[model samples]
Target: MAVAVAVAALTLVPLAYVLVSVVAVGPAEAARLLWRPRVGELLRNTVGLTVAGCVASAVIGTGAAWLVERTTLPGRRLWTMLMAAPLAVPAFVNSYGWVSVTSAVEGFAGAVLITTLSYFPLVYLPVAAVLRGMDPAFEDMSRALGNGPWRTFFRVVLPQLRPAVLGGTMLVGLHLLAEFGALQSLRFPTFTTAIYDQFESTFNGPAATMLAGVLVLSCLLLLVAELRFVGRARVARVGAGVARAAVPHPLGSALPVTVLGMAALAVLALGVPLGSLAYWLVVGSSTAFPLGMLAAATATSIGLGAAGAVATCVLAVPVAWLSLRRPGLVSRVLERSTYIAGSLPGVVVALSLVTLSIAYLPTVYQTTALLVAAYAVLFMPRAMVSLRSALAQVPPEFDDTARVLGARPAGVLWRVTLPLVVRGLGAGAALVFLAVVTELTATLLLAPIGTTTLATEFWSNTYGLAYGAAAPYALLMIVISAPAAYLLTRESRRTVPGR
Candidate 1:
């Protein structure tokens, strides 16, 4: 119980500090800031990009998932891996690739394109999982009743896919809200970019906090809407019946067109960015790699990522256990609280921490602890989601069985529940660790004066047009993040039922 409380406290402190400092300036100041032209523009851009990105991701992700999971498409297994591999390529990397290919691709359109490419996988993974798990009986019955492929897909499969689609869409939306590097690189202005600008140009913590408060409120409203509209139903298949795969509808003359289109998208999203990175690496190698600087940045990134991952996983365990086993208003609230902080842009969280630190804990200001706190706030949801999935697999009956055998609650948790869920916990930690390694906006703002991570190093070198110098850091980030991405994809595939 004490451990749980401490984890919860750790997760909440940064958020609380941010909120209190924002509100400390009072409502009038916040209101005045909201009325400013800059705020209005930021709001418009943020909402527009989020809406556009979410819609595009849903369409693309769902389509890809359907093709890979339900179709008799050739190379299905390979396609599944290719579909998800884009997640390893960060949004900024994708943006850099696109920009390298064409100078014109560096605005709103570029932001949408890069973000969609990077994020659509979020939707694809879950949708594919749910589709794979779906019993084909419904579709088989529909066909027998004379419904065409399109009609059956709409009337039968899609309705059943609502929960998964919505869940994936929610993840995409949250990511869009928090997105920074891609948007900044694409020369788009959103609340996140505005917050970063305010932080960078002038250390206006109160104003930045004010904007962050509004950003949080905006995210809360979206969360409420998603919960209300998306519903709270599980989409898993029940029973031990052998569910056959859905019959793949032949595209006939359209097959060539469909295949080509999908292939082109995959190439554009995954291939182009990678090609650009390779080019830069080759060019940069001519000038020699900055071995020492690279080593220091790599070490710093790994250390912080490891620390944040462990911290986030530890904090997420209690929240997951509470929500699953001791679920109630409080548990639910605690669970949702993490999301509130998680969904905000890293800039917002970083600035909020900066404000609180400068005013109250100046001693720890610009320290690693403060940076890790920002990471915990920004990436906790990934840990929570993985933990929740792990907890779900550990049946409540197992706990009851342990109690019946005379084991105490703590002992049962340690000996039975913990063992069962530790894999999931480790997977969750890996997810957070990878995310932290590539994280940019927050690290830029919160990292100590001399501290450098791969992300900051890449950003600096790239901004200065030192493509060769930037290549090594970018390469290192990709290499470090690759294993984690693979683990996540493997775990997701294994746990996702049929597919």
Candidate 2:
């Protein structure tokens, strides 16, 4: 509990900074700053993009999962891999690809389309995992009651998928709220992009923090909506009956159409970015690869990503364990608090860390440790969510039995608990590593002097419209992220048919 509280305190630093900054600005001044036509315009753009993106991603992701997991689609295995390959490509990199290809993919429509393609995998993976493991008895019962196939799915299967769907959509919404690179490149003016502009263009801390304050409120609203929709209902198996393999629904005449649709999704999500990278390498006049610089940046990105992933997951274990084992108000609040930092834009989190470090700990300012701490603050929720799910599946009886055998607390954790939850740890670490590898705003602001990460390098080249020079960094990021994405795919294939 003490460890969890400390972790929560660390995670809450960014929120505290926002509140303190807003208070320092005084209420009237804050109101005056926020009450403007510009703020209203930004609010409209941010809210519209978030809502539309989440809905579109949910629809596409859920539909794709159902097709791959439940129907007799051709090449289910291949489709599973292709659906998740988008995660290997960052949203910003994906936008870079689209922009390089055509100018038409800009503004609100383009933002929605690009983000949905990038993030729908967030929804698809979890929903597919649920679909793979879910017992089909509920469907059988619904069918016996005379419901048609679609009706049975809506009334029976969809309800069971609520937790996974809600979890996924909430992630998409929060990600959209904090998205910076893709939105900026796509010419969309959202809160994140506006906040970055305010800070960079004017160096006005109060104005930027005030914008962040509003963004935090939006994050709170999203959390509330997700919580209310999720409720406290349990969605697990009730008895000890082992789940049987789900029978795939035959597509018959629709098989070819389903295959074509999957192919189209793959083309949009994976092909565009890759093809654009190859094109830029061949034809862009400014395209040049400096091997020495590229090697240094790759090493730095991997080093930082690995360090940040380790630190974040280590901090997450206690919080996740407490929340599951205690199941009380304090634990719940601590766990939920971690998500607030993650929902904030990377600029907000980075600025907060910068302020605290400069004022309170000058020695640590502009250091690798500070940067790693920032990564933990921004991405701890990813680890927490994965750890909590993993810990939930582990029976407490195992711990008790170990204790009865004369094992100490540390012994049980290291000897028994760790082995059982190792996969969860890996999954959480991989998720954090992937985020850190692609993180741009935070790395740009917080990284130590002389440290250049792949994300920062990619952003610099792309910002100058040197697509050819940027292509290599973007491609390396995708390559580095591929192993993590594959691990996630392998982890989700628990009950996939024919596996």
The digit string of per-residue lDDT tens for model 2 on 1-499 reads: 8998999999999999999999999989999999999999999999999999999999999999999999989788888899989998999999999999998999999999999999998888878877987889889889999999999999989977776787788888888999999999999998899889988898888888888999889888887787678665545453565678788999999888888888999999999989999999889888888999999999999999999999999999888887776788898889888889887899889888988999999999999999999999998877876676567556677778999999997788789877777776887888889999999999999998899988999999999999999988998999999999888787667642211
The alpha-carbon deviation from the true structure for residue 300 of candidate 1, after best TM-score superposition, in angstroms, is: 2.7
TM-score of each: 0.88, 0.95
Show the colliding residue pairs in model 1: 284-468
- Clash tally, candidates in order: 1, 0
Enumerate residue pairs that collide in model 2.
none
- 9-40 per-residue lDDT for model 1 (tens digits): 65566567668877788889878867899888
Q: Model 2: C-alpha RMSD to truth?
A: 2.4
lDDT of each: 0.77, 0.87
RMSD of each: 3.2, 2.4
